[model samples]
Target: MSTPLLSLRGLLKRFGETVALDRLDLDVPSGEFLALLGGSGSGKSTLLRMVAGFEAPDAGQVLFDGRDLAGVPPHARPLNMMFQSYALFPHLTVSGNVAYGLRREGVPRAERDRRVAGALAMVGLEGFDRRLPHRLSGGQRQRVALARALVKRPRLLLLDEPLGALDAGLRERTGFELRALQRETGAAFIMVTHDQGEALALADRVAVLEQGRLVQLGPPRAVYERPATRFVASFLGGANVLEGQPDGAGGLDCPTLGGTLRPAGPLPPATTACALRPERIALRPGASGTNTAAGIIEEVAFRGDDSLLLVRMPGGAVLRVGHAEEDGAPPPRGSTVQLAWEAAAVVPLLG
Candidate 1:
């Protein structure tokens, strides 16, 4: 691959007695949209701030274009950050706010005006240049902030919960817009978001963090479909993790699910858990496979496109299942059904 436009090597950060980050390393290729995904206090914001020069790592290096960024002031970095607040100047009009960065950089007046206009146009805010931040809608304000950040033509753009301020509908809509804008501009973007759907939908690659440590990093599909650990599978949603130990006959003896799960391939002797996505499981009328178990639908939640089923297995384990709406009305609550999944769908996870 081409040289990474940005690299964080062995990065470490701490606050008092808490370790905010622990020897984390990541590489961002040019124009790749990477999302740092984690729950609150997972060091995602700390990592983003470190890259933006707002915070310093206790150890290791933050490199951009192969140059160390140690001691680089926030304003001196060749990157721009858009915060959750949008941070557009309420006193300045859209164009003025966008032009502020260029003016700070001491660009010529004509160049600043041209770039401001182009940036506003890029974000679909061409006609709102004279509107103040308070006069614009939340989405518009967000666009203005984006315009300001892009106006400087930064090599890397950092977004911290960029869509967090918008309503659910708008947040989902803008997520696609942001992804499109990133692709159109070809500027590498590193977004920090707690929303799993946002990260999975917007990012080309996702870095999953847990307790200040890098837990998993990969393409969205890979990370979601083949999570490396129980935390990842649970955090990303729709995973039923069961305590299991290798049965020695190429199957995992899962007492909770009351079955022996035979994954597609051989598992390590130490493997003690198996994770299966809810959507990967199918509810059938009768048991037919080694990976099948009988369960009663204890609860059902209709989620528009799909219905979520809480299946209580005979062993008293509640396994969440995502049954497609098209499969007909979900089995009524209290109805006993067979839950089956292919052996290949079972992912053996090590503790």
Candidate 2:
């Protein structure tokens, strides 16, 4: 295989009592869009900061094109990091702001103008060059920030919560625009985000973090559809964990779980606990099966397209099920209901 454009080898970082990153290793392919996804304390932002040179790793190496980036200052690296705050100059006009980096780099004024204008056009803010940061809408200001970052034409772009400040609608739109821009420029873009939906929508692959460690890394669909462990399933949501007896072949035989559930992934031999996501579970409702469980509806939450049903099983485990139909209106809350699913849908997890 060709060498990754960027690689992190055994990278480690710590901030006083907290271990921000723990021997993290990752490789970014050329022109790929990667999302560093995690909760508030998961260390996604910290990792991004380190990658951007704002913070240095305590150990390990950061590689660009197989060359070490050790000791290189932020500006010397072939990268640009767009801060979460945009960090736009309040006093500079849109064009002036976008041209800031170019001017600093000592590019000729005409060439700087051309590159800045091109970058602005790419972000759909070509005509807003005369407007100051205060005069621009939130989205427009963000586009200008993007233009400034892009004008430099770095081989790699790091985004720390790029859409965190925008409104919901604008955030959605900007996600698409960013993806399109990545493809057009063929630059490797790594984004840090706490929003699962944003990661799902934009990333070619996602790296989910926990306490500074990468729990899983894969395409968005693979990470969501086939998580690596109990931690990943639970973090990504929709998983209904069940304690079971391993049946040797990635299958779990649980008396109350009502089926012979096979591991959708490689289940370690000692695993006694398993999880089946709500969406993967196909109910054989009211049908008799080994995988069928007797449950009482505890709560039913109505979402427009799907409903969340909490079912208390005979074994005392509460199973969260998601479905478009409420299973006969969620069995009238507290009524006994039968829940069944396929063996393949069971995603086995650690004990």
Q: Model 1: residues >4 Å from true position, as ranges?
A: none
- Cα RMSD to the true fold for all candidates: 1.1, 2.2
Kindly report which residue pairs in candidate 1 clash with one another. none
**Winning model by lDDT:** 1
Worst ten in a row by lDDT for model 2: 323-332
Taking the tens digit of each residue's C-alpha lDDT, what string does model 1 give over 13-123? 999999999999999999999999887899999999999999999999999999999999999999999999988778999899999989987999998889998998888
Task: Give residue 66's error in model 2 in angstroms.
Answer: 1.6
What's the C-alpha lDDT at position 25 in model 1?
Answer: 94
For model 2, how does the per-residue alpha-carbon lDDT over 305-328 read when each residue is reduced to its tens digit? 777888887666788987667444
Estimate TM-scores for all models: 0.97, 0.93
